[model samples]
Target chain A: MSNKVHRRRFLSQTAAVAAVWTAAAKTPCRALAANDSWGDLTGRLVYDGAAPERERLVVDKDVDCCGKFDIRDESLMVGADGGLMNVYVYLRSKVRAIPPELQKTVEKQVLLDNRDCIFIPHCMKIWNSRQEFYIKNSDPVAQNVAFSPDLDQPANIVIPVDTDATWKFNRPQRKPVPIACNYHPWESAYIFPVDHPYVAITGEDGTFTIRGLPLGELEFQFWHERTDFLETRDWPRGRLTVAIRAGLNDLGTIKLPPVLFAKK
Target chain B: MVFFSAALVVSGCGQSESPGFRINLDGYDPAKVSQAQREAIGEAMEEFFGTPDVPRVPQELGLDAERIAVAAGPVEGRADGAQHGVYRQHCAVCHGISGDGAGALATTVDPYPRDFRLGVFKYTTTRAGAKPLRSDLRRILLRGIPSTGMPSYAQLTDRELAALVEYVVYLSIRGETERYLVQRVIDEGEYLPLGADVKEEVFDEAAVWAAESWAAPEQNPEDTVVVPPPRPEYTPPQRAASIERGKQLYASKNSQCVQCHGPKGDGDGENDLLYDDWNKPKIGVTPEETARLARLYRLPAQKLRARNFREGAFRGGGNPEDLYLRVYAGIKGTPMPAAGPQAGAGGVLTPEEIWDVVNYVLSLSGRY
Candidate 1:
């Protein structure tokens, strides 16, 4: 009995593999270029201002004041509007020179699904070297869109219920951008501009590390959407001093002082 | 007479038989015969010829005197008291004297003490987390929970450990049987006869079968309630603009949604690693419980537990609107601060901005 069952399974697996191979053979030829020469770039995108003031409400249906709300009176709200937080800075070393392997990995369309009335991933690092980003609304509710610019051109489009939309950037701008849904004002996130793959995002602990750099003094630009207050104070903006040695080198802690916000 | 005796012996030898064929009837006295000689004669007579009387016991043959001098070696004994005493001293404090887990320290814990009385042990491969396998129990006992107060007891001897395991199982079975009976009484109200005619039992079985018959259909709260149809798809240029806008809003500190919700929307915010409101180290509930609650709320487990967020229940929420309402209207009697400026509260973001924030928050859980 056991031998019979095993034989059946083996036959089924072989059939499935054959079907897959047949399907692959029928697929149209789309050549993918692989570029091994492209290197990674890593840096921090800082927001130099205290986070914006917003009402933080707790929702408890059983409470006596279930609908009652309050504003937080804290000194700071971390990673607020246009904060340039969790930006993925990468290198686009060979922009037009597409290698076969690299071209295959470049997706023609990237989908961002909106379900449960929120962005599935609060933040996304898109390598929009090829296809434009497609925003999809899977819910049956109204939604509004807001974008802050680090792109060469500013784009803002409102998305309605159960609709799909796309946003395209014609040129690269070396600045971190912000995006939000105005219908649900509390929903917000950040995007960083990069032409390379060498960038890494600062984790929840606000620490980022990038490794395997060629030995040299490389000039890197760091831009954040919340750069107004920091620039005014003459704090370091858009540039870091580093002498990359052949071996591992530790770039010590980078600190940005608290940005004060005036009461509205 | 000598010549006759020699002739008898020679004849007996020739026949391969003993030469004790004396028939002296005149001078034969029974008392004169030794005990050994009488026994041998009796045995030979029984073997060679059929005899009626035969001795079974030594006393029956007047040889009971020889049995008094043999001494029996010391009998083997076991030290069961010492093994039991060790368990009572070391284990009774937490395991209880009867291993029912109603020890003095059972109370005042977030998760109640492991009630061995029910034999429903957690952290086991057994069915329904009940009754840890013997080896499973030993592993827990040897390696106690690091953060909790349970300490490891790896010092017990192999023999002692074996004895303790048996005793624990005995106590658990006894207590669990009692608990099961009591629970049955409470649940069933009264004991019914086998195959009793009960309407409730029939109705319950029918309901179960009906529920299992097909996949559940989506619920529509009200047939009369008219929902607006979905909007038309945006043009390529319009969508491109929306993505740009979404990206811009994400980078700005004006929203600050990424602080608590997490940049990746994985819900592992910096605050998540810190101590919770109850001063307990924050390790979220088990994945199984989370999954069960998600099913109840009709949402995916990856989404935040914001849907079922009732004021009384500080941790969970029920729906997208429910979380939206919580964000708009703060929870009462809890630390979950509000995010809307209405109700004379700090309404920093306009109604439109709140909607945007709602969209962003929903997006975190794939609700957007």
Candidate 2:
């Protein structure tokens, strides 16, 4: 074939493929619309019985101790027994019935201010479809804003003095993005972006409450940034599964296991 | 032809014999140039000199022109001349036309430009009560400060430097004079009369005026100044109660301390993840990410957590009042939130709550 004719044919074939992909992508949203009822999924994150764990492990060895390393009074552990906090518990499968009023409230823009060289809320959760958020720097100094997502493209933005900036993520991902300010080396924050709005950050007492859950029996997934990932079949590191019902339900205590050490 | 030749010979002999020299001169007379061309040339000359007026002594114009005379001398004059141009081009943008350093730029530069009006320069070699020497100003001009937008004018010549120094001093004198006049006006409501021959007697008249002013109907001593009463010290029980209340509020649901700061009060909160504004991994987090996390949450590092109370560096403060102050005042340049009601210009917490928060934080250090 002549070069011009070949180019024309290639262009036509590429356009046809793109049209087919766009049509296929819209099908999932339509399917999700049919089952739009909200459901409750409750479970406790527990550490499986295993070998003794190391407490307050210093993964980064370069930090010099101003004094002797002390772990006894440290608040590393959460719950009454000091377990990990911020263990996200949510349904593994998709369930769609969200109330119209609840949806509106959920859609409100979440504000994260970088004041005095620290993120106001250390941990935040937003629905997957939520695209934009306000990040402000109230500090007199400049701060670097970096986000590392497990599945999507990461972004690094520089927040100038006394200025506010915004970041938007179009795709949905289940993992939390670790954030840190480069100018203020010690400043850090976390952002959990997911398709569902069933996530909650654990409070100071190492407790999290997710209210307004719909009535149903559902399997939930628990994930913490500090602990290892857990699967449905194998409830690893700090994972759990439970059946949630209508009304208020408290998932018993969740314990975070200590870090595993290999014998030399 | 015979007579003409004879005459030429006679003239030549006369010129040679008399020892007179004569030369032919031929060229354009610049004086006859067109008026437009002359004006254009004059403008070009002004542009070259960087100023319209020829340099002159300040004393000739009834100004304290000592500095100007000194600046025009060979050693300092050249430097001052170069600096004068720089001052006009850059410093005058803010320092003002008078060199009082109260230029238009003063309104924009934070901590405002130095008011040379006082002739008191900070960041100088001179000690307190001493005036900065010429070299001190020169050094500042050469090396610009970091973190500020001031740029160094190291390219100026020595003459320019000297001229600038003199001009600055001239501005200072004028500014001080202006201030003195204003002060005199404020004190007496007008310029006080000074008799040509009066000395000690002038003070007697002034004292009388002062007494009359003090007793005047419009004057009230209390209106000039007001002082607040001192705060009473808290009793032991009061202190204990405040600390207890503070601790309760800290662990409450609203504060949410445990999430990032671990339960034991260490900095290892469960959400201690190293992320950036974009939710990406921060650059080079391999070495000190965890320590950074602890610092962010205001948690004492593991090593510091076990230290004796005396050995630990108390960042917020040791005593309840000190802690309260920290919570109330919020560290000026840190992320530690001000727990006090009036921490920032418009803080959210109430004064009582700020005290409670301070008491609670101090309790964490085992100070109760």
Candidate 3:
């Protein structure tokens, strides 16, 4: 059979070329607008009630390797000061102006290590469709990362001891995907993959900062593993639309009520 | 009066007209997707890709409309001595009229027949995350998947095979497009009577993107196809050494093939609760939700078993090269991870190491 560029390919390629040309034509104007409007989003997710005691997960298998460390359910973590940890906050839209620093961040590899039979950083945000996700197995026991993304392909890979592997998603996910190890069922983590860099995960102190966002009206989503969506006052679907300013936009201590975490 | 009208209509026709494509209800959220919205989606799908009796393809998709005609409609010998309705005559029984994989005998099989709606094929010569080449799909039709109900249609002529292959592609694209439309409706909370704007927006990206992926192999065969290096010829001792190396790799923590495929090469592995991409969705986050989701799906979620080297019936071909590809690409949509080198990145196992693993697998099945 003769090699021929299919019609769809031809159309898409021409469209891409046109897009590049147009982008080049307007680069100066866009650069001015971007630099003038770029800002940051800083916030802390705080649990309204007292800190809930985390239940220690039972580690029955590989006691010498896995049970050496005290493993606890990282879901719904609250610090002494009522700061909630591992809350995901991200821009709702797929398309946005990506700053140079954010573009560079996509180039660097993000690590998800299996240390002491626990997935390090229980929650993470992969900020681009083609971002390199590095997976390392630091423990001695065998671990398999069941990376299942709804829109993209799912991989259940066996990452052996002291070895690391890199994975990249072809498509940005609609929602955060849960990665788990079947061997150690308790070993689980969540990853949010988006095409834009406007995402942040809360730290142990419940703090997160997403810098260099294009100033304008933008919608953001807050999600947690325990509570499906961090539904605050009047923010349905945990989505909050805000008009960003030229400087730091501080959304101080957004309190989460205990009722949101109640299980039926 | 309604019953009388139905009876009259049934009596008037010699045979009942087959039902149109049923939208995959599981794809939608009942709370969000209204009955009217579903009807709208169904109508749009029918408009883009016609009914089973008379199919149609959008010109922009660049699909082979001629082959679709040969495969659709009632099974009959045309005046030009060509065959029609080849799909219904051969495939619809298991794959269903819409290629949803819920035909008459679908539930009877242990592992359900593939639902082409997802467009995720497990076995292919293509690399990970890439659509299979035309030759890959042909290979499946020629050599039927072992240990499954899907049978080989080798008896069919080249023309018949081509028609069937194109028809399958057509059904996959149509099914995927329908899913895309449904997702958009649910995501956007669009009301009934979907306007022309929605159709155009969906067709411009969803359908066009799907068509591009299906055409990728033909357009960029070099990038899509996974070509294994030439197999090393070994003397008796050399072959033994390769198998030994493979056995170690299989058992070692580096590859950990023994974790799922047992130390004895038996299917019984440590982790028994393994599920594929198809069944994984049916499993909800909570046990209660899992029960609810399970009831909604066609079949109960089935656990996937690691292939037993002792059994030796590889679902993908039993050739050395096939085994090489399996280890290299990993079984798509399954738990088997790609052990071979990927594009611009190294995998868990090197080419030589994968070769060793293949030799060990062959030895387990007494192929060596």
Candidate 4:
């Protein structure tokens, strides 16, 4: 259509839209910004076949500190009945606009304690941008916490013995990022920064519940620490596109086969 | 009753203002063009590109520029020159207004943002010596380089990213034209005046060159990327001896790796203040220009950090062949010099020696 014709049509429609908007704006439109009523997404991502055996690590570098404890590699964690831990299940919805309501729900601080030369949480999930991390070094020896995000500049801060520092991630990560201690190469953890609040990390029991997700056809992706989300995503056990309704949406017992994962 | 009545009477209303464009002679001085030639150039540009507030080329060419304007308009302080706010927020801080890779935070960054004026992009899927594919740009926009300050704008809506990509192409073309004009003026040895015919020809040729870089790929098959030969897997004995040899080579003055990567492979080399290809200092720059460039870059001279091997986040993948390719090709646009056979006489390391160095570097991170 010509610009003149398009403008004319637009003007006429504008008046009607304005009147409708004025009427709609009388009631609170805040809820429209984000989901007011939220449902829960619950699931247990477990190993499909026989669980992979834990491999012994060669703690050749820091023998004095690292040798005190026999550390098994935490790359793959499996429990009774093939329960999996350290698996990140988060909403893959393209809606990046953080709901103001959800924004208010961010925790003041998530603790990451370094005790016995290991990051407390092997896999961590930051809900929203509002939250910051408090890294505490419980070990007597000084430890460095180095984060290498593919999207942002890498940061390595040395925390003196028994001291703590506060850090917050400015950028959101699409793929899971690894946090390694240069001094202790064996100490590795993963950080999955999601834009939305509906992200959860599996516990030792290998179960997770993502809370307060908006009602819609929400897509979720599963990621493990070693899983390269950039290359292939078959290990995510196929995508989950579900029409979210009120109350609970149980994905129930998802399986991750050992073959697809090339554990480092 | 209200909902039904509203539905019955109304369709979507009001005009969302279409996006606009303004073409500037990127990285070129206006003093070279004569008054008449300048006027003619301006008129031609006006015909080709519309005012910043209202782009006319898309309308004339039946292109849809508005539909592709950023979905979330100009978040994170990025904009395109004065008119394009989205580019400034995300890209212009590193890639300057003229796409020169010299912006407020340009020099502070390692492997500086690409100077689109040269029309060279390092990471691309379209083989060697070809303009990067739009998909390649999109991938970088979405994924972002991990080790750099470039963060992923994956959250950006599809339309927003597509619009940004188009703006980049526009800037590259503009920069290329500016370069072409400057070269022409230099060749002619003329002062303050170029004939209108020359100006027109130069502008037209530049546009064709820049435009063809994008268009020709559609018809012609992409040049196949050269794949490196397979690396030999080292046995325990070979691995130890090779690593020892690599250590000796690294310490040698000829290797030059020690100069930048340091004795411990900690990245604190003696010559830490080196420039990458993108930020390679050039002559013919006036003191005023240098000051202006510095202000634009907002940094003290920063250099690319030699990869601290112990803390391994290899930018070009971490596989065996990936490391070999890196050692062979060296990282383009960075201070890291390539040591491959194809790197010419300067490439002192033999293929086996390069492998040995790669083995040692990998062993530092325990990857080997």
**Candidate 4 i-RMS:** 20.6
> Which candidate's lDDT is highest?
3
TM-score of chain B of each: 0.31, 0.34, 0.93, 0.61
- A1-264: candidate 2 lDDT, tens digit per residue: 121111111122112211110111112221212343433333344443442343442322112221133322111225443535565665544654555555667755667886644576777776767546677767554444656353233344545456566556544544566676533445556777776666766654556656445545444555555542333333432233444444445555545445421110
Candidate 4 structure quality by residue, lDDT tens digits, B75-125:
222333222346755777688655677677876777677777656565554
Top of the candidates by TM-score:
3
Q: For all the predictions, what are the DockQ values?
A: 0.01, 0.01, 0.17, 0.01
Per-model TM-score on C-alpha atoms: 0.28, 0.32, 0.84, 0.41
- Give one clash count per candidate, in the order shown: 114, 53, 0, 17
Better of 3 and 4 by DockQ: 3
Weakest ten-residue segment in model 2 chain B by summed lDDT: B18-27
lDDT string, candidate 1, A150-182, tens digits? 213233344445556666654443444566553
Error of 2 at B185 (Å): 85
Q: Distance from true position, residue B239, model 4, in Å? A: 4.7
Candidate number achieving the greatest DockQ relative to the actual structure: 3
The candidate with the higher TM-score, 1 or 2, is 2
Could you tell me the lDDT of residue A165 within candidate 1?
65
| DockQ of predicted model 1 | 0.01
